[model samples]
Target chain A: MAKKVNSLKYEFIKGLWVENPVLISLLGLCPTLAVTVSAVNGLAMGLATTFVLTSSSIIISLIRKFIPHQVRIASYIVIIATFVTVADRFLAAWFPPISKELGPYIPLIVVNCLILGRQEAFSSKNNSGRAILDALGMGSGFILVLVALGGVREILGSGAFFGFTILGDWFNPWMVMILPPGAFLTLGFFVAGVNWLNERRAAQ
Target chain B: MKLILLFISAAIVNNFVLSYFLGICPFVGVSKKVSSAVSMGMAVTFVMVIAAAVTWLIYHLILVPFGVEILEYVSFILVIASLVQLVEMFIRKVSKPLYDTLGIFLPLITTNCAIMGLALFSVLREYNFIESIFFGIGAGAGFTLALVLMAGIREELELADVPKHFQGAAITMIVAGSLALAFMGFAGLISI
Candidate 1:
């Protein structure tokens, strides 16, 4: 029906703005805060998560009916862990430097609440087509926020963007921005900004 | 002396929550009240110690010896998930009062990432059995310290007229940033 198709489109678009995972749902803060100290690291982490999220979404959607109610959580985790291992090994074998930079985080993705949350919340209920769309939508939203966070921290903390000097000679990088405190502070402001924008849009 | 240094480093200098960002979920989610934060901290610390010991054995004994180190992530997560369940069941059987306090938080620990980070970090640093135990205590202590401090601040923050937009997690994160800045003072105390 036209109504069903429109609702599906709404589901996909919501993830980008209305239901931005990092800012709104706040599902996966561990990796979001940890890896986004730089743009590239954030991008790598986001992409790897996207691959895992989308693949796992498809698989889980397909098998949702077969998974017993009692063991569904465990089953979902196992499926997610398998894909995470693949992503981990691929990164280590190919992009050794990026892999090193990410350190344990690539493996830590196994516990990233976002991927698990998606499977539990969206994929298990929806058909494969909608599950895939939801995965891609949420993944894109996650990637966008991560890249933005990384860019803010990178430019402010290091006076660079993706390792390139963007702020020029006049700027003295705020060392704290690249440090642990900076991650929290930048995210805090970004979250506030998103909330303000949403409030204003609702008011109109 | 060496063990003391390792403990101090893990607890203060290189805190799991503040510096490494291991357990932000519970750090933010459950720190609404000091009492619950302490409860969650204890549960995590308890699991961290057991997980460290078990994971170390699995890696050094099963995975490493069998030449299947590639199963590290999968195995570690599985170990942690079941361990949380085991700990939950054990507590319910042993003490009803204790379970009442920590009952809900037990299942949530499976995805806490702090436990998994503990397992992975111990392995990464190649900490032996004894060192790993101490490391678990230290990290858990650090997590507890941060959670309790955050809870204390948030209790007062409820009274403060924070801007509406930064009311929930946003404000908490900023406070955490300031706490992190304060924690950085400990960096000079130890190099590691």
Candidate 2:
């Protein structure tokens, strides 16, 4: 029994990198691709998702024993949706511009598989403390990927980072880097590049 | 005439899948076979239309009247969830073959994001009931178009020799990027 609990830590840590939500699991790709055109947007989205994920995970874990297996998924979604509503309203009321830039993607967080996936896979069976840890790790992993993608796109597309100019007049922005195609191409290469790095590491 | 423009604009000019990035999970997951893609498309279209109508009423009748607009996300998602359940049972009882075709996809539609995005976009744009319906249909058509086109490409891609790393999702993304570039031609069509 003690050994089993120890392995839960491993599961929690795996979500942070070994099976990172954006990079490895490949869940929640829509928001990951849609909102990363700018670093600020990406950071805001990541934090918003983290708030929802962490809160919902704790709630679900606390109530996991009560929810029926058949209706567990539905229950989890309702919990997530409720938290998402809170996050959405908070952002809209306080940070209207980021909310506007994010558009429907904010509400679309309810549909993000990462939050629900963690609840079903981890929180439902784990204690509250473990669930919280797992949620935080997964949330951080997601934020890391979004920040990296956002940084790349912002620098290449606008020669800026987080809306501040880093590259001077010598830099001619690649207009495509900020467009829809840029999102897809950049993510594709990023995935391939990550896989290449992992392969090299494994060989050594 | 207005409806036609709305349909065309949603379906082509601002495609939900390619341009807006809605319904991408199914756009990637269910686009492997043309038949399943069609089924998934139809299921999504059905859900989107209902979601738009229902969410519109909820927003106006409930959220706005009560001044609890903060509950929009919670209410919209709940509405979508129950609606999908209702659609599933209705299909299962009415027609077995239809249910089988759309069975698994129906539950998935509850979280498709395209349906939710349609509802949210309609509200954001302040469209009337008729316009919202049109928007839903148009978005569905656009999703279907992209899914079918992608399925066709992937079918042929099976025969081609591809690099190992770019085999599964990387190639799909690269292809989708090109497709997005192609669709950008329609950007000049509608000013919206």
Candidate 3:
């Protein structure tokens, strides 16, 4: 029915904001907080994650029916790990600087619960097409958050966006924005801000 | 003496959880109780040491020799996953009580970024076999220290009336930020 199609659309759309992986689910906080010291790092990490996520979702969807229920989690992880390997190797060989900047995080993507959580929750149950769409939506949402975090940190920390200076001589960088503590503090406030916005919206 | 300093620096001066921000998931999730946190920490330490040893051999002996160092991420992840499963089964068969305590945490360890991060860092730093093992133990101990301290704070925090928006994860993060700042004092202790 038309209603079914509409609901499928809703499922894909919701991941963008309503249930954003970073803000709402709080999944994959490791990379989100770690690699966002620069906008370029965030973009690279986000795109790499998207590649793994989209590819794994498609593959999982194609074989969802054949995978045994108990072993599904293991299967999804293996698939994800394989794709991550490819991404990591590609980055190291082609983009060594970004790879080094990201450090071990590129490999850490394998265990990112966001990808596995999606496979278990949505991809396993849904058809291949819907799963791909949902994966894309969620991946895009994650990328947006990474870019925003990276932009804020990069601009404030070094007066740059993606290695290009956005702030002029008048601006003095907040040195903490590039440090480990800044990651926690910034994300903490960002999450609280998201919650506050939700509350106001609901009240309205 | 140098090795001991490496261990101490990694474990305390540059803690994986508090300073480096690796493995925040379990740092927050499993740190609700002191006992559970201790168990999780020990389990992580055990796997990390083994993983460090195994991955070092794989990287230096196998991957590098084959000129396929590019496969490091893939192989490391797969190795960690299988290692977790192997350790879980071995523990269950050998020690029931220890298995019971570490039962749920074993599977969770597979996803703990600290394990994978330790492996990658070991290779990146080109640490030798013994150094890698020490790094693993140090990172594990660091993770445990952070988790237990956070749990202790949370226990006391249960009494405090946190602001509405800062409750739960938000407040936990802010507290962790302060802890990270405190840990920063140790940074100057070791030049490495």
All candidates: DockQ: 0.86, 0.76, 0.67
Question: Largest TM-score belongs to which candidate?
Answer: 1
Q: Report the lDDT of model 1 for residue A104.
A: 93
Q: Rank the candidates by DockQ, best first.
A: 1, 2, 3
Chain A vs. native, model 3, TM-score: 0.94
lDDT of 3 by residue, A1-204 (tens): 353553678777787899899988889999998999988998999999999999999999999999999888878888998899889889989999998888788888998989999999888988888898899889988998899888888898999987988799999999888988888888888888888898999999
Q: TM-scores of the first chain across all predictions?
A: 0.96, 0.95, 0.94
How many residue pairs clash in each candidate at the backbone level?
Answer: 0, 0, 0
> Which regions in candidate 1 have their CA more than 4 angstroms from the true location?
A1-6
Q: iRMS for model 3? A: 1.3
**Candidate 1 on A44-125: residue-level lDDT in tens?**
9999999999999999999999999998999989999999999999999999999999999998999999999999998998
User: Residue B188 CA error for candidate 2 (Å)?
Assistant: 2.4
How well is each residue in B1-192 modelled by candidate 1, as lDDT tens digits? 888998999999999999999999999999999999999999899899899899999999999989999899889998899999998999999999999999999999999999999999998989999999999999999999999999999999989999999999899999999999999888878775
Candidate 1: deviation at residue A36, Å? 1.0
Task: Give the runs in model 2 whose Cα sits over 4 Å from its true position.
Answer: A1-12
TM-score of each: 0.98, 0.96, 0.94
